[model samples]
Target: MADPKGFMTTPREEWPRRPVEERVRDWDEVYVPGALLPIISKQADRCMDCGVPFCHDACPLGNLIPEWNDLVSREDWRAASDRLHATNNFPEFTGRLCPAPCEAGCVLAINQPAVTIKNVECAIADRAWAEGFASPRPPERLSGRTVAVIGSGPTGLAAAQQLTRAGHTVAVYERDDRLGGLMRYGIPEFKMEKRHLERRLGQMRAEGTKFRTSVAVGRDLRAAELRARYDAVVIATGATAWRELSVPGRELDGIHQAMEYLPLSNRVCEGDLAESPMSAAGKHVVIVGGGDTGADCLGTALRERAASVTQLDIYAQPGAERDEDIEPWPTYPKIYRLSAAHEEARDLETAPSADADARLFAASTLRFTGDGSGHVRSLHLVEVDQARLPVPGTGRTLPADLVLLALGFSGPDREDGLIDQLGVATEPRGTISRDAGFATNVPGVFAAGDAARGQSLIVWAIAEGRAVAAAVDHYLTGSSRLPCPISPHDRPMTV
Candidate 1:
């Protein structure tokens, strides 16, 4: 256990971020350099070492949270890292990206701020890389079986790493020029730099994980051909079918999906262009969503020096803190937690009185108005009640040169013909259907991650990937030792 009275003595402290004004000028991450190391031990020591750690139940990975906290408190960086990597295949990704459901379930959160589980997890993994403890672990002997993993996202990469270490020859195929599906293009560099991804890819290659880029499985090579060449196949194509707004003016030339606009900025960071073709520069941008993607667009638009940026949300703003009456203990609460992007945006907003936040809330977009030439010029919206009915005399208009829809994804893009070729069934909710063993109806074929479970957090994707690999190993060998922690349909107890 960590320090006995650590929770009482030490307060919850997060790693400080770079000043918003300074960070906006560059595409680098928002955190201050070397900020967490000095205080990490004290933060880790805040773990209560509860008799019943609900954090394990909260995390799909079943991460050894308290064990690692103790290890970190003791300054055993290598041991802490080993404990962290035992379940999660990609702590670095989750650390930087995940909402940290484990912290939400922390025993400390019942009465106090939760322990810094995500920060400690990230620190352990980063330390491992710095100390050369994260060297490649190639298999001793080949199992002679081969596996083809479609999609180079977290799930596919995790499964490939596990299967390769378990002695199977593994090959990952990506449709884009580079590996990392959403992580590569969808995520901005200000959140997680590509160097973190590049180093991990280098390690995977050294461990004998063959990568084939710019190859679309169903389009270029037939599904039958992929299955024929491999002993098994794992599909992690991910749900990228972006949801659309069917309101009037949907076809405005300046309006685009979040995926379309987000990736263009990512390409600019890759030196593809000095300026993104879809840039919000000199424009009045209006984002019509309230999720992480919307926040990302807000930050990016501000960096591009948009004349003004406004975000629209249909729901009213949440409370400053969780209300037990609505969302009880151990549950993920709906609270107003300011994200790094939101923090930066609040500093620049120049509104006086805000009925529903100076930006927007409880507002429904009526339609967009474009110029005669077809470029968007303005947006129309109305105030909405609790039931989303438009209120009277609440209509307003805002200038909009470029608009983005971050309304979230619907399902996997099946237009490429991969699902039809494999003959796998899809659920009514639009995700791929899989058995308890993570296998589809077709033998030797399996699915995991967002493709199977719908769009979710990075930790869940890695856990799904690890669990699916175990199932594949068992299917091939009849008996296997790989750990299968959760099945496809297991939803978290907490919201």
Candidate 2:
């Protein structure tokens, strides 16, 4: 509403990324700082403030997108931050990491480029921090109820913050030495700096949310014992078990899982190590799998100055444009995307002989070949059909010194004694089984996030946390006032 003809007058312009050559040399964020501020307000003004905002429905958090967009456009950053924080607990995290399905569902996106909702949201949150508008709000009265929240990921952190503000004594337990779960370790620092997480943790601490790191539940104490110690227990331990490749030569010395390689790089950034144990320097690197994780590996390997880099995907390359019938507007599209990492890879592929990258679509890995030193030397590959099945006549070999398996995660770590002690039912797919209310078969216990829902986005994790907190509060007090953002059975608009 800031400008009635804003959508017509201005076209969408995205935030600028740092130049490929300059950014890949270090672990800095890909986006150029201060580059989006000039155009962000204008881009935000594109929101029509429609009568029925489908973008709300598209978001798992049900973020007040239009309201905040208008507020940002008008330069009312305080009000915009309030509106953005009303639903989402971590705008900075989602702004940096989320794929922004809300933009896909923008009404204008049916024809024109969608409003810059994500950029506006990040700007509002950042301005709030700078202006001191964001502060902890502790409850005036204590309810004297104590709760134990297992996990320190987005879901557990959101639930812990909400419950603590609701006058409950909440403690968040993390198995890792530091808080932020995968956000702290699994995610590369180039995608999002760890200081953002530290600042939020500071605010949560000020709000009276207690944190217990390096003390895993069901190991330090039994699940039943934990329930006895607290009035209620909320499980948000995320899926940690990586989906593995069972092809031949899986035990080669230079072969590693994406999780193994990613965490080591993150540790190096943390100054915990001088270098990554799985460094790709001077090695011919081949990454299998073409998901976001694979792209992440590609970027990291290129930064390490690999001799050469090649990425293989079993599926055919996705179309550049969205498929209208199968994926309509107001829902996340199935179009191909060029992530920052992919952009760098493409640049490298077209660069001079000194800087060359390679990508192979519809390629399947058959096995690995190792040298006498027990280190990976090459990969056995085959050209895959449209169905992703290997074709016998199209086999070939590619020289490789380091092979990274970038397949996604499977489920929560069952080895963590928690699952064994609780005896919670699990789906055939390995995810924890929960009812519509996010309640497990056991009474007075509830589950949320990747632990229950499988691998998903931070936005979905926060939504599940909000929903699970409401159900737990209702069970505890016979009524609840917390907003249940999403149901356990509700899949994302993208799904």
Candidate 3:
């Protein structure tokens, strides 16, 4: 155990972010660099180290939470990182991005604040890199099988790394000019710097994972030809077909999908452009959708110096604290929480009121009003109740020089002809159909991550990648050594 009475003695503390005024001025990571190194041990000690850790059950990747927590508390960073990497391929990505369902299931969270599992995990990963603990682990011998992974997101990266370390010849295909699908463009650099991604990709290259960017599998090369070239194929393409909000004046010029707007900002950071064409600068931006993506839009707009930012959600506002009666211990509760973006938004002078949040819960967009030139100028919305039926007498309009729909994704992209050409089947929900072993209907072709499971977290993507790698390894050699974190149908107690 980390500390016999550590949970009792220590108060939970998370890594502190840089001041809002300072952080909003630049695209650097939100944290004060090296801030956690001093206080992390005590935070790690807060783990109760439960006999039956529900943290494991809540994490789709089944991360070894207690082991790493203990190792961190002991200041055995190398060992802690090793234990972390044993199950996860990229703790850095998950550490920065994942919602940390494990903490929601923490035993201590039944009463007190949850153990700082996410912070500890991030510290370990950052330490591992700083100390040269994270390195290429090339296999000693070849497995004599070649596999192709489509997409360069977390799932494809994880599967490619696993297959490469397992001694299989792995080639990852991405449509973008550079690698790291969403990592390269979908995610903002302020949340996670690109250097972390570059570091891992460097390690993968040293370990013999071949990357082929700007090559569309179904267009640049047909799916059938790809199948013939490789012994097996894993489709790790993400659910990118974003859900739409069909309403009057949806065709306004200033309106765009969140993916469309966020990626451009990322490209500006990538030096592809000096400024984002879709920059929210000087605009009154209204983000529709109350999830993480909406918050992302909110933060990005604030950083871009938007005149104002407002986020709208159709669901009723969540409680500030967990309601155990509604969602018992060990299950992730939908409680109101402030994210870094929300924190930044709170300080904006343009906030609606002295006490009001930038977010408007239980609000539904009725339509948009466009300027004479057909650019959006205002958004019409109304408050709603639990049933989402709008409450009368609550209709309102707000200036919206720009509108971003962060409404989430629908399913995988089938327009590329990959699914059609491969003859793969899809579930009614539009996700690719996979068997118990993560295999698609087509022989020797498997699917994983959001491609098969719909839009989900990075943890699930890594788990899906690992599971699919195992199935591919078995299909190629009748038996395999790769670890399978979960079955195709497995579900974690996460949203």
Candidate 4:
């Protein structure tokens, strides 16, 4: 550590964000650029570098948190980046997108605030890129074996990069027109700029990973044909089937799913579309769901200049502090959080303007009331009990020109044709079923990430990718050397 008593001397300081009024008008990232460089080192010093490092146990990727924290505190950014990337294929992505369970598991967090592991991590990665420490790592020798990875999300990309560096020919397939799967389209630019993704894709290309976009495996080519062409196959196709609200007026014109609304806004930001078909401009928007996706919709709708916004959740409002009985030390807690969007909403509510954002908890949607033209006019809701069952005599109607269903996903889209043709077994949850090695019932084929594990964090997806690559490598060759972070039988302690 840089200072033995640093924790006592300095309190935790996070990166500063742009003022709410200023950031709400554009799609740029909310955090102020270069704001963390000054404070992150001091924050890194707060790490105790515990004897057992429970932070590692908290992370599904098993990131070397303490080592990098020490390295950052010492101002050895180059070394810190190396340590950070040793296990993770894309620290930049995880650094921005991950919820940072490692911080929750920090030994210091048992008493005081957790060490700023996530901030230090993002700082180290940004410094590495600025100093040119991050570059392609090509293999020394070529192996005769070849592998096909389906999907361009974090899992597929990580698997392809690892296999390429292992001297095996690797080709990644994506159904979308571009690589980066959800990273490229589902995520908005305000959360993470696209430049970070582009630079990583460049490095992967330099490292001998081939990408094939817009060529779906089970649709354009038969699964049998793909199996015959490649020595082994790894499927990292993420879960894309959005869960629907089966209430009355589900087919109303202004009612749409979160996936449908989010991607359109993202594409508009990328200049691919002149305008989003589901634009929330000059409308009263109500988003149903209390998850990150709902928050994303809240932000995007605000940016689109919605007249008013309201978010509803079936669950009761979480406590401000962690509940000791439900979530113990070194485990992720269930507590109320104020995301950037929510912060903006609070600021707007206190403004002089008449329009303000609203949020309702323990609420359930009864149905939609539409005008004669089939356009949504209002939403019918009722107060819900602890189990989200509707309570009597609490029914109300609120005007709503647009309604976004952010209820999250069910599983992978079976319409992909690959699931049907391959005849792979699926669990009751609708995700592909795999054995301990991540291999499906069909031989020489493997599945990973959301496609196999259901919807989850990017870190878990990457871990699944690396682990599945090892299993596939072992299947193709008698022995393997790829690092397997987690097996199919292993579930995250925090989960």
Candidate 5:
């Protein structure tokens, strides 16, 4: 146990963020650098280390939350990092990007605020890198087997690293010019800096994981050719076929998908462009979805000096407290929580609309009216009930020079012909079909992450990656030593 009465003695204190005025002008992460190190130990102490920690069940990666929490509270960072890495392949990525469902299932969260698990995890990962506790662990002997992993996102990276460390010659192929996939382009620097990604990639390279960027597998090399070359192929290409909002005037200029807009901003941060061609500067932006992606668009638009921003959610606003009848404890409930982007929107008054948080809940887009030049001028919408049925006489229009659809993704993109050429079966939901062992219909071919599981949290992606690696290793050899943290049927704790 971290402390017998630590939960009673300490209240949850999160890592502080930089002032809005300062962080908005720059692309650096929102949190104050080096801030968590001082307070993280105390925060970790708040963990009860319960006899039956539900946090383990909530996390897709099955992270050893209690062990790491205890290690962090004792200031045993190396041990903490080891325990964290025992289950998770990339705590840094999940520590920053994951929504921390584990905290929602924390036993303490039944009444008190959950122990700062995410912050403690992030602190441990950052400190591990700083103290040289993280290093390459190359295989002692080559297995003489080769594996080709498609996609360079979190899933592919995790799978490749595990396979490489298991003595297989692993190669990861990415369609983008650079590695990290969405982490390189989709995610803004304000959320997580790329330096952390680069550091991990460096470690993977030293561990004998090969990377092939700017190579679309199905196009550059046929699936058959790849199958013949490598002993096994793991498809970790994430769900990228973004969902569309089909309505009147859908083709108007200045209306784009959130993925389309977010990546350009990331390119600007990467020095690939002086400015984003789809910059939201001086425009009234209307985001059509009120999820993390919408918030991401909101933050990027604000940094670009958008005249105003408003995010619309189809679902009604949730209450501040959990509705136990609807979503029970130990399950991830849909509650009203303020994200950094929403906080910025609220503080800056950038989004002037029905909701104070720069969000219009129960709102649905009707159509976009275009200016004479074919550019979007305004957006029409209607407030609705929980069933998404429009409320009568609730129609309204808002100035919308730019419209972004953050409605989420449907499935993996088929543009590269990976699925078509590979003869892999797909589910009705557009996700790749995988067996209990993460194997696709085709032999020697496996699938994982968003490609198989559909769009999900980064934690799930890494977990699927690790599990698929073990399956592939078992198929190649009669037995395997790799840890399979999760099964293909496992899902996050959600209502």
Candidate 6:
């Protein structure tokens, strides 16, 4: 238990964000540095530490929330960090990037605002780094078996770290010059600085987990050779084949996928380029899709000084409160959330004719009108009904110099040839097929994360990575001591 009456006495407060005017001018994170520590101890006290904490079920990683909350409330950073890292490999990434379904499942959320579980977790993680609580935990003895993990995203990194700590020789293969997949590129610096990622990579290196960059396993190194070299192979390559828009004039200049646009900005941050070639500076940017990816684009465009930015969502806007009948407690609900980017858009008034946010809910793109020089000039759209069918006479147009499709991804990219070369079974939805144990049909082959689960949250990816590591360890040896968080079929605690 965190505090006897803290839940009732203390109101919920979150990590404060920097002023919009200043943050949008730079690539630094949106949060006010050193602000969370001052308020986090009180927030942790608000945790009731219920008899059956649903936060564990809500989190795919099955983190010991109550234990860490108690530790944090007592200002015990070492114990809190140990408990936090017991299940999760990278709390820093999750604390920054994850949407925090754990808070929704909190017992306090039944009536009052939930304990700031996400903020508390982030504070604990940050304090751990500052207090030197995070250190390399290398294995005591070496195991003869070896493992090859493809992809360096959260999933791959988690699996590699677990197996390496279990005394197995592990090597992670990444195609890009950097280690992190989407985290290094698709995610913007405003949400989470890359230094957090770099720090964890350094720890993993010290723990003896090898990383191979700029090496596409299917092309640069044949899957056959890799399979023969390693005792087992784990395909943790995330779903990266992005969805497309087939609207009229989609091929016009200035039309690009979100991936193509986001990576350029990241490259500029990495010092690989002085400026992003696909920058949104002084342009009217229209982003299709209202998910987190679109919000990311919105923030990046704002930072790059876009003249105007608008986001389109096919689904209608949700209410502020949860519909208890449709979504009961402990289950994640669809609610209107004003993200940092949307707040910036509203406060700065960078959107054209937008209400509070730059989003146009229930609006569907119809076509693109181009100038005589073959560059996009404007976007045509129509309001849609619940069925997503266009409503009569609800057409409109908006200036659009750059059109970005952030419609999300379908499955793992096949162009890498990993799927074909390995001959792994795939589901109808294009995800790699795996058994309950996260094992593929092919012997000694395993699949996890987005590659097997389809595109999903960062928490789910890390959970799958830990579970797959346990399965791989058992296959290599007769038994294992690794903790398996979830099965392949296990899902979130939702109605």
Best by lDDT: 6
Model 4, residue pairs in steric clash: none
Candidate 2 residues lying further than 4 Å off, grouped into runs, are 350-358
- Write the residue-wise lDDT of candidate 4 on 316-363 in tens digits: 788877777888877789777888888887777621221224578888
TM-score for all models, in order of appearance: 0.98, 0.96, 0.98, 0.97, 0.99, 0.99
lDDT at residue 125 of model 6 (Cα atoms):
88
User: How far out, in Å, is residue 310 in model 3?
Assistant: 0.3
lDDT of 6 by residue, 1-495 (tens): 758899989999999999999999999999998999999888899999899999989998899999999999999999999999999999999999999999999999999898888888889889989999998999999999999999999999999999999999999999999989999988998898999999999999999999999999889999989999999999999999999999899989999999999999999888999989989999999999999999999999999999999999999999999899999998998999999999999998888666449999999999998999999999999999999999999999999999999999999999978899989999999999999888999999999999999889999999999999999999999789999999999887767
Candidate 1: tens digits of C-alpha lDDT, residues 1-495: 768999999999998999989999999999997998898999999999999999999899999999999999999999998888888878889889889988989999999999999999889988999999888989999999999999999999999999999999999999999999999999999999998899899999999999999999999989999999999999999989999899999898999999999998999999988899989988888889988888888888888888778888888888878899878778788787788777777786722223333358888999999999998999899999999999999999988899999998877899888999989999998889998899999999999999989988788888888999999988878877877778898877654
Off-target runs (Cα >4 Å) in candidate 6 are none
Q: Which 10 consecutive residues of model 6 have the lowest summed lDDT?
A: 347-356
Deviation (Å) of 267 in candidate 6: 0.9
**Higher TM-score: candidate 1 or 6?**
6
- Tens digits of per-residue lDDT for model 2 on 1-495? 899999999988998999999999999889999887788899988999999998999899999998999998899988988999999889999998888989898899888888988888888888889999889888898888888999999999999988888888999999988899989888888899999999999999999999999988888777888888888889999999888889899899998888889888888888999998799998988989888788888888888888778888787776877788778777788666888877887887722221124567778899998989999999998888887788879887888899998888888887768987987888888888899988888787889999999999888999988888888888777888999999988886753
Task: Write candidate 5's Cα lDDT for 1-495 as tens digits.
Answer: 768899999888999999998999999999998899999988898999899999999998889999999998899999998999999889999999999999999999998898889999999999999999998999999999999999999999999999999999999999999999888888899999999999999999999999999899889888889889999999999999999989999999989999999999999998999999999999999999988999999999999999999999999999999899989899998999999888899999987675857899999999999988999999999999878999999999999998999999999999989999999999999999999999999999999999999998988899899999999999999889999989998877766
